[model samples]
Target: MKKKFLVMSDSHGQNDLVQEVIDKESPIDGLIHCGDMEEAFGKDLSFPMYFVKGNCDSRRIGKKIPYERIIDVCGYKILICHGHLYHVKYSLQDLINEGISQQVDIICFGHTHIPLITKKKGILLLNPGSLAFPERGYQNSYIVLTFSENGIHYSLKEVMEY
Candidate 1:
C-alpha cells in the first residue's frame, strides 16, 4: 500500500495558517510538523502526526514534543528533527552525519526557513521551509510525500496553491 504524508515546518505560532494547511491537505495518511509549533496548535490534530521540537519552541511546549525521532514507513527509514542540534544554518554536513549514524534513508528538518529537497551522498534531505515566515527568497511552502515499495515521491506546494 502507498502512504501519503503532508509535511510542514516552522509554523511558529500561526494557528490559523496551520489550520488552513490542514484543511487544504485533508485525506492524507499522515502529517509531519518539523517544529516550533505552539502547544495549542498541536493538540487538536485529527491525523497521525510526527512532531519535533524546534529551537524557537516555547518552554511550555518543549517538554511535550520530541527533539528527534525515527519513523518507518513503506520500508523507508525517515529521520525527523528541528535541525538546530546539527547547526543546519551553517551547513548540512552535521545533519548528514546524523542521518548516516542513525542509518536512515531520509532526513527531514527545518530551521533556515528555506524550502529544499536534495540527495546528499545517498540519503534524501528535505526542508519544507516556514509556512508562516519563509526566508531565502522562498515562498511559504510544504511538502506532500508518497511512499511505497518503489521509493519516496515528493512535491513542494505553496501555501497559496492549496
Candidate 2:
C-alpha cells in the first residue's frame, strides 16, 4: 500500500492557505503538523492528523498527539515531533541521535520556519517550515510525502497567495 502524507506546521491560526492546500491535494492518508497551529487541528480537521506543540502554541497539542510515536507508513518507521524540543536549528545532532536510538527511518520536525529535506547518518530529517509567517526571506511552503516500501517520495509546494 502507498502512504501519502501532508506535512506542515506553525500556522498560528492562519488556516486559509493550509486548508486550500489540503483540499486541492486530496486523498492524503496522514497529516503531520509540527506544532504552533494554535490548536487548529482539533477543529475544522477531517483527516488523521498527528500534531506536536510548538513554543508559540497556546495549547500543548503535542501532549495529545502521542509524542515519540513510531508510525508505520508503508513499512517505513516515521518519527515526528515539533522540533523545538530538539532545538532544531541550533542542533539537529541530538535529534538525529535520538532517532537513531529509536531506530526510526525518517524524522520530521519544524521550528526555524525553514523547510528542509536532508539526510543525516542515513536517516531522513525534514522540516516543513512555518506556513503563517514564512515571509522570513523564503517562500511560504509545505511538503507532500509518499512513503513506499522502497523509500519515501516527496515534493514541496509554495503558497503564492495570501
Candidate 3:
C-alpha cells in the first residue's frame, strides 16, 4: 500500500492558511506540523495529524503538546520537532545526533522559516518552511511525501496565492 503525508511548519497563528493547505492537499493519509502553530491547537481536520510545540507557542499550550515526536510511516521512522531545542539556527549537528540516537530515518523540523531538504549520515532532514511567514526570499511552502514498497518520494510545494 502507498501512504501520502503532508508536512508543514511555522504557521504562527495562521489557521486559515493551514486550512487552505489542508484543503489543497486533501486525501493525504496524515499531516505533520513541525510547529510554531500558535492558533492551530485543537483545530479539527480530516486526516490524522501530529504536532510539536514551537518556541513561539504559549507556555500553557506547550505543556499539552510535546516538544518532539517519533512516528512510523510505512516502515520509515520519522522524528518531528520545532528545532529550537536542537538549536537548528546554529547548526544541524544537534538535531542530527538526536536522529541518530533515536534511529529515525527522517527528521522534520521548523524554525528558520526556510525550506530545506537534505541528507546527512543516511538520515533525511526536511524543513517545510513557514506556511504563513516565509523567510529569505522563499515563498510559502510545504512538503508531500509518498511512501511505497519501492521507496519514499517527496515534493517541495509552494502555496498558491489567491
Candidate 4:
C-alpha cells in the first residue's frame, strides 16, 4: 500500500492557511508539522499528526509538546524538530548529528523560513518553510512524502494562495 504525508512548518498562528492546505490535501495518511505553529491546530484532524514545539510557541504549549520527535513511517525513520533548538540558522551540524544518532532516514525542521531539501550523510533534510511568513526571495511552501513499495519520493510544493 502507498502512504502519503503532508509536511509543513512555521504556520505562526495562521490557522486559515493551515486549514486551506489540509482541505486541499485531504486523505493523507499523516501530517507532520516541524513547529512554529503558535497554536494547537491538530485537534480536529482525522489523520495522524506529529508536531514539535518551536521557540516562538508559548510556554504552555511547549509544556505539552516536545522539542523533537522520532516517528516511523513505511519503514523509514523520521526526525521532526523545529530547528531553533539545533541552531539551524547558524548550521545544520547539530541537527545532522542528532539525526545520525537517532538513526533516522530523514530530518524535517523549520526556523529559517527558507524551504530546503537536501541530502547529508545519506539522510534527507527537509524544511517546508513558513506558511504565513516566508523569508525574502522564497515562496510559501511545504513538502509531501510519498511512500510506496518501490521507495520514498518527495516533492516541494508552493502554496497557491487565492
lDDT of each: 0.87, 0.78, 0.91, 0.91
Cα lDDT tens digits for candidate 4, 1-162: 899999999998888998888888777999999998998884577789898989988563658688989999989999999999899999999999999999999999999999999999999999999988999999999898899999989998899867
Candidate 1 similarity to native, TM-score? 0.93
- Candidate 1 global CA lDDT score: 0.87
| True-structure lDDT of candidate 2 | 0.78
Steric clash pairs (candidate 4): none
Instruction: Work out the TM-score per prediction.
Output: 0.93, 0.88, 0.95, 0.96
- Compare candidates 2 and 3 on TM-score and give the better one: 3
Model 4: CA > 4 A from native: 60-62
Candidate 3, superposed: residue stretches over 4 Å from native: 60-62
lDDT of 3 by residue, 86-150 (tens): 99999999999999999999999999899999999899999999998999689999999889999
lDDT of 2 by residue, 1-162 (tens): 677899887788777777877887788888887777875544555568777667877454445554445677777788888777777779898899999999999997887888889999989887887787874788778889987776679887787774
Q: Which TM-score value belongs to model 3? A: 0.95
Error of 3 at 50 (Å): 0.3
Off by over 4 Å in 2: 42-46, 58-63, 66-68
Residue pairs clashing, model 3? none
